[model samples]
Target chain A: MAKPLILVSNDDGITAPGIRTLVEVAKKIGEVVVVAPDGPQSGMGHAITIGNTLRLDRSIAFDDLDIVAYECSGTPADCVKLAKHHVLKDRKPDLVVSGINHGSNSSISVLYSGTMSAAIEAAIEGLPSIGFSLCDYGHEADFSHTREFVEQIIRQALQHRIPENTSLNVNIPKKSSEPIKGIKICRQAHAKWQEEFDERLDPRNRKYYWMTGNFVNFDKGEDTDEWALVNNYVSIVPCQYDMTAHHAIAMLNEGWEF
Target chain B: MAKPLILVSNDDGITAPGIRTLVEVAKKIGEVVVVAPDGPQSGMGHAITIGNTLRLDRSIAFDDLDIVAYECSGTPADCVKLAKHHVLKDRKPDLVVSGINHGSNSSISVLYSGTMSAAIEAAIEGLPSIGFSLCDYGHEADFSHTREFVEQIIRQALQHRIPENTSLNVNIPKKSSEPIKGIKICRQAHAKWQEEFDERLDPRNRKYYWMTGNFVNFDKGEDTDEWALVNNYVSIVPCQYDMTAHHAIAMLNEGWEF
Candidate 1:
């Protein structure tokens, strides 16, 4: 049988250590193709390049590993679109995977995650996808401990396939002394970033603000992604792109005069 | 009783006619304040600026009406953050509204909508928020017909309150011969943009691509937002920030081997 074609991408750019680790693992299981941003695109949410021109350049970043790759001058979501519709137009990828991101995208952070945006973009295109992230935020975050679990999750995803019209948001705990307990199927925790702007003056003496925030978790349920990561386990939250609050429809219909 | 403080914003910059219409309606109901992007930020979904500085300047755009307004160098979500954290720190807004956007943001377009992002950002901050959009995509779209409906929706939202943790995504039909029948509480229709990249060459002879697409609606459901808009009714879909597919969680737990 032909190897399953896997398309790999990330928001940390094509040269990030995280994508390299993902590529290393994916190549062992299937045919891998990489299409990612040329530079870091953290906090780029589901942004797409509109009213702007995009450049897609072939890259030699994966030459040593003998893998095909391209660096795109666009957001993570844009890279996925270019990949599916242009680069891989003739052949459909068996699976699309994004990230092994250098940080967490567990709860409300998902709303601002470029890593998951790539995965969600693929999900919107009717492809089975997963976005992986480590809870570590350091520039040189350790991805060694995550390799085995990453492979396991990918294999399981290929075998069972993700639930229809959904993508998996898999967040692994950072390297720790204790072994990971197991994987937990969890819901997104009710959480948010309490933003605090750091007011500063530039050389021109004009005021500018730096966005800083504190993640505040309000959900205490053990079934939440936050709880799973806190307990040293891999958390998988199946996510759908449909933003509609179906339960609220009846409420509005009953109460709203219009 | 004191007047309700209504916070207004948009992705079409501080000076767009769409926002002017919104301000005209909102000020009639309550005290109004505006914080929006300095330039067009359409299609910038949930994005926020990081690794960069933001500029927030007081604007005289609403000076004639004596309304407080500011323009920020950031995305729609960032505008809302600045409004909540810095601009309006001492006082909490009774309501938050974003856009009478120049274009449509129905169905899957919501995933790429900057207009909805501001409203969703406010929802995450625990505020009653609504994003209004006119179906017309013209530079000078006719918002005349939408005035009454926009006002009605805002009044109803202020009176009845939106569902907890949800923001309203309301799309008004473009002005036509026949009047709008009524408003419908609807769900987002299953749809997607089939991207067609228009390859071009820059002045330097470098290949560039323009992202353009045709909106395709696959859902034939009468209860969907697309159906309502097509049938000349204002469509309102309550949108939530949570992307988790709860039903798929149990399925993944039972079917996949962790």
Candidate 2:
């Protein structure tokens, strides 16, 4: 049988340590093709390059490892679209893996995450996909500790089909002194960013604002991603791109008159 | 009793005619404040400006009408965040309304929609929000016919609470000789874009690609937004920011092992 083709991408640029690590793991699973953003695009969400043109350039990120890679001049979602429709146009990959991101996309953050956006784009294309992230945000955050679990999760996803029209959001807790706990299947927690803008003066002494925010979790349910992270467990959330609030349809049908 | 306060925004920039029509209609309901992008920000999903400095300037778009408005140098989601945190600092608005967009945001288009992203941002912040779009992509498309339905939906939303953590994705069909049928409360259809990148040579003779796609609907269900739009009825889909596929949790727990 031919090896399963795996398309790997990330928001942290093609050469980031995170994707390098993700590539290392993905190679063990199948034939790996890396196509990712040329620069960091952390909070890009599901943005696409519509008004602007896109550039897809060959990169030597995995030259030593003898893998095919490309650096795309667009957002994460753009990267996936370009890969599927241009670079890998004739052949669809068996699976798509995004990230091993520097920071978490555990709950409400998922809505603003470029990492998860890539996975969601693949899911929208009817491909099985997974986005992996670390809870650490530092530039040189330790990723070695996540290797075992990351491999395990990817293996399972490739072996068993993810639920139809769904992608997996896997967030690993930062390396800790205690041995890592097992994985937990969880839901996205009810949480949000309490936004704050730091009002400041630029070099010209003109007013400009820098966005900052605090993450506040309102859901106390144990089956949530937040709970799993706090308990040092790897959290896997099956995410779907269908934004429809199915439960609310009945409410609107009954109460709203037009 | 005080009239409900409505925070209005759009992805087509502050001066666009679509928003003017929206502001004209929104004012009939309550006190209005507008904060939107200074330039077009189409396809900018749930992105927030983090690494970049943001500029917010007072705009005279609604000056004659006596409504407070500001133009922000950011994405649509950034407009909502800036409004909630900086512009409208002390007082929270009763509701958030985005668009009256120049283009459609039905079915799978919602994922890449800056218009819907603003409403989803408001939903994440626990506000009752609605994103209104006309199924016409032209800049001068007639939105006059949509006003009555828009007013009715907003009135219903303000009178009765939206389901918790949910926003409304409302799309009105373009003007026709036949009047629009009543609004239909619908779900996001199972659909996706069949992407095609129009590769071309730049002035520098470098190969560049323009991203384009055709919308393909796999779902033929009558209860979907696509069906409602084709029938000339306004489609109202309740959208949620939580990406969790709750039904798949049990399946993941049983099928995949750590």
Candidate 3:
């Protein structure tokens, strides 16, 4: 008869509107304990600060929820690491959720996303996890339309359960004329970011460059995350981090002559 | 028949002795082209620079090899992105190999390795790829013993070709008085990093934490990356980026009515 114990995190720092929104939605479903990065970690991917130390300072940002929230001075993966071993050592969370990110983490964006990295870290710990992201990349991107969908998915995940070794990558389309067209189960679109760097010079005239890129979705398939997002539906792509190409194993065996 | 156009890259930067040795070995097997990060990118994982500009500068390090080499001001994955879309646009690499990384990229290290990410990026591009790492992490890590192993694998790979969607995660244990105990096609060991931070006070008296961790390999399976490394053997685990837990899918389907 107890509510699910949910471990919440995000790539957009602890005080970011996105994670605050995530914490609010999660608290309604269960006990929410948040451990997230102290700063924006948008394109951090699966990085862990191994060569540096980590700091987890308690935050009063979400006092309304009466939740235990910590701002970690590390990557999203490091947040999960600290939460599991240090913060929540005695109790195991029923589900771990990350993001409600400020930008899109659909398709190949997932590969470069720290939002999903937090979820992937939990999956590595054998916990059922999900990462959520919005297509809009704004500080105060409206998340009102996503609240219902986010709550429904979390509730269902607790009532049922996701598969092992698999974590859900849920991406919501930006503010739309129509409310979300409902959730669509889809695979990650086969896509990549086409890189284009903008060279800049500081006030002192030292050359520096700002990294920029455009997302190119070559996959026109309807069953992909890109297609789902374009159709005004939140896409739930069950992602795994094992990276074992099972299809190529047999062929490699044939080619590898000892 | 024309030789395979091999794109070589790594995480220890383009100048690390590890990569120089890798390029030396790769030149024998194919038309090697080096595209790696300009500086050390240890533990970078699958990161791609998005909020900043990426620059690609030709390298003089491999001038002797007559190979086209570029040093990208980005992560390992970013290097591959530039190589594919910008540098090698006309010809797709027949094989993409990354790292003779100066450390163990076995088991859980795979998730945090910039080396493996390049290989995974190549696999995503539908090219046969592999990542090679030495068990040694020292700057002057001895690579004499790795030549035979590296050459043999690439030759076999180029001749027969690797399986689709898979890339090799090869690790060579440090050279010893004994010959290698041969290769073990193994799975990633179940492991986790027990992290502890070393906090320090800055000049302004603000506390900052430095990241540190000890790897713990809990999986005692005989056929695992950790076991192979420990037993003085090379570990070759074929890894793919698809993270779907196919077996768990059936279970989730039966349990979760959604």
Candidate 4:
């Protein structure tokens, strides 16, 4: 049988250590094709470059490795779109993998994550997809410890594909010396960021403001990603793109007159 | 009664004719406070500015019109966050109105729309919100016939707040001489873009690609937002932010191995 075609991409630039690490893990799964943002699209969410144009070029990042890779000059969503409709137009990928991102996309942050957006775009295209993000946000954050967990999840997902209506959001906790705790199946916790802007001026006497925010985790339950990360365990939350709150649908129907 | 405080924003930059019209209409309904992007953020989805700082400056766009406006250095989602948490820190807005957008965000496009993102952000913040867009993408697109529709919907939404867990995604047909048909409340039609990357060689002899895609509507039901917009009527699709596909949860519970 032909090797399962794995379409890989990320919010970080193609050459970013995160995607480079992702490429390494994906190669073991199947024939890996890397098409990711040419630059970081960290908080890009589901943004597409409609008002502007996108550029794509094959990357040398995978030259030494045995994988095909391309870098796209657009948002994370655009990378998936370009990959499916242009680069891999004639052939459908068996599975799509996004990220191994430098930062976490757990809970409310999921709504603004480019890493998750790439996975959502692929899911919309009917490809089984997953987005992986580590708790660390530093550019040089350590992703070495995440290999075993990443491989286990990827191998399991490839073996038993996730349901059609769902996409996986896997967030690994920062490392500890002890053996990493096993994965926990969880739901997205109700959480949000409390933001504040710091006003400042440039040397040219021009005013500029820097956005700063505090991540306030209001959900105290042990089931949340926040708790799992704090407790030094990997969290696996199945997510979806359909924003329709069907449970609220019936309640909304009764409240408003159409 | 004292005037209602209406917060206005758009994905199109502040100078766009669409937003000017929106400001004009909103002023009649209440005190308008405009917090919009300094540049166009068309497909920004629900993105927020986390890594970078956001800047906001008071604007003189509608100085004589009595609309207090600010040009923001962030995505639509950031604009709403700034407005709610900073700009109007004291008084809660009676209505949060986003976009007299230059283009439609009818179907799956809603998930990638900066216009709708602002509205949904307000919805998540427990405020009444509505996003309005024209089917035309042209800069010079006429909105003369849309005044009454905009006023009607805004009035209805304000008088009777939208259903809980719901915000309105309203799309108006382009300028027409014929009498306008009434509004239809509907669901987002399932749709996606088929991307094409236009590769080119720059002056430096480097290959570049421009992303382009034709909008594809696969939904056939007459009860969809796509159908309503196509039939020359205003479409009001109640959008929500909760992305959990709850129906799948039941099935997952029945079939999954922990």
What TM value does chain B of candidate 4 have? 0.97
Residue B62 accuracy (lDDT) in model 3: 91
* Candidate topping DockQ: 1
Model 4, B1-258: lDDT tens per residue?
Answer: 998899999999888888888888888999899999999988898888876767889998889896789999899999998898889989999999988999888888888999999998888788889999998998689988878888888887788678875788899988777665778777788777776778788898887777777889888989778898888878888876655444554554455444
DockQ (Cα-based) for each candidate:
0.91, 0.90, 0.49, 0.51
How does each model score on lDDT? 0.95, 0.92, 0.84, 0.83
| Clashing residue pairs found in predicted model 4 | A211-B53
| Model 1 lDDT tens row, A128-154 | 999999999999799999999889999
lDDT of 1 at A230: 97
- Residue-wise C-alpha lDDT for candidate 3, range B105-224, written one tens digit per residue: 998889899999999888877888889999988877899999999998888778787776678899999988988988777778888777665668878876667767798888888877
Query: Lowest lDDT 10-mer window, candidate 2 chain A?
Result: A249-258
Give the CAPRI rating of model 2.
Answer: high
The list of candidate 4 runs beyond 4 A from truth reads A177-179, A220-224, A230-232, A247-258, B203-205, B250-258
**Model 4's TM-score against the true structure:** 0.93
Ranking by DockQ: 1, 2, 4, 3
What's the candidate order when arranged by decreasing lDDT?
Answer: 1, 2, 3, 4
lDDT pick, better of 3 and 4 = 3
Summing lDDT over every window of 10 consecutive residues in candidate 1 chain B, give the lowest-scoring window.
B249-258
- Per-residue CA lDDT of candidate 3, range A29-79, in tens? 889999998888878889888665567789887877788898998889989
Tens digit of lDDT per residue, candidate 2, span A5-79?
Answer: 999999989978999999998898799999999999989999988899999989999998899999999999999
TM-score of each: 0.99, 0.99, 0.90, 0.93
